[model samples]
Target: MPRERILELRHRGRSFREIARETGCGYGTVRRAYWGAGACAAATERSG
Candidate 1:
């Protein structure tokens, strides 16, 4: 699944397990995606 879709789902209050199930990904994948994206966003905010 796309990162944007995953983030959108997460923004809507879905749990990691729920996102994994809906996106056909493993729980770890969903969790890592969220974390990785957050880290990138934080880095960008700090730099920008």
Candidate 2:
């Protein structure tokens, strides 16, 4: 699944469970992907 799409859904106030259902992924996977994307973006911002 696209990370940006997941992030967008999350930003739009979708819960991890909701995103998982929509994206056909596990709830844990959705949560991890969202947090991982956030971590990566934060790292990039700090580094840049």
The alpha-carbon deviation from the true structure for residue 11 of candidate 2, after best TM-score superposition, in angstroms, is 0.8
Which lDDT tens digits does candidate 2 get at residues 1-48? 656767898889999888777666778777777877432333234435
For candidate 1, what is the lDDT? 0.66
Best by lDDT: 2
Clashes (N, CA, C under 3 Å) per candidate: 0, 0
Candidate 2, 33: how far from true, in Å? 0.6
lDDT values for all models: 0.66, 0.68
Model 1 residue 16 CA deviation in Å: 0.7
Question: Cα RMSD (Å) per model?
Answer: 8.9, 8.5
Q: TM-score for all predictions?
A: 0.66, 0.69
> Can you write out model 1's per-residue Cα lDDT over 1-48, one digit (the tens) per residue?
556766888889999899777656678777777876432233234435
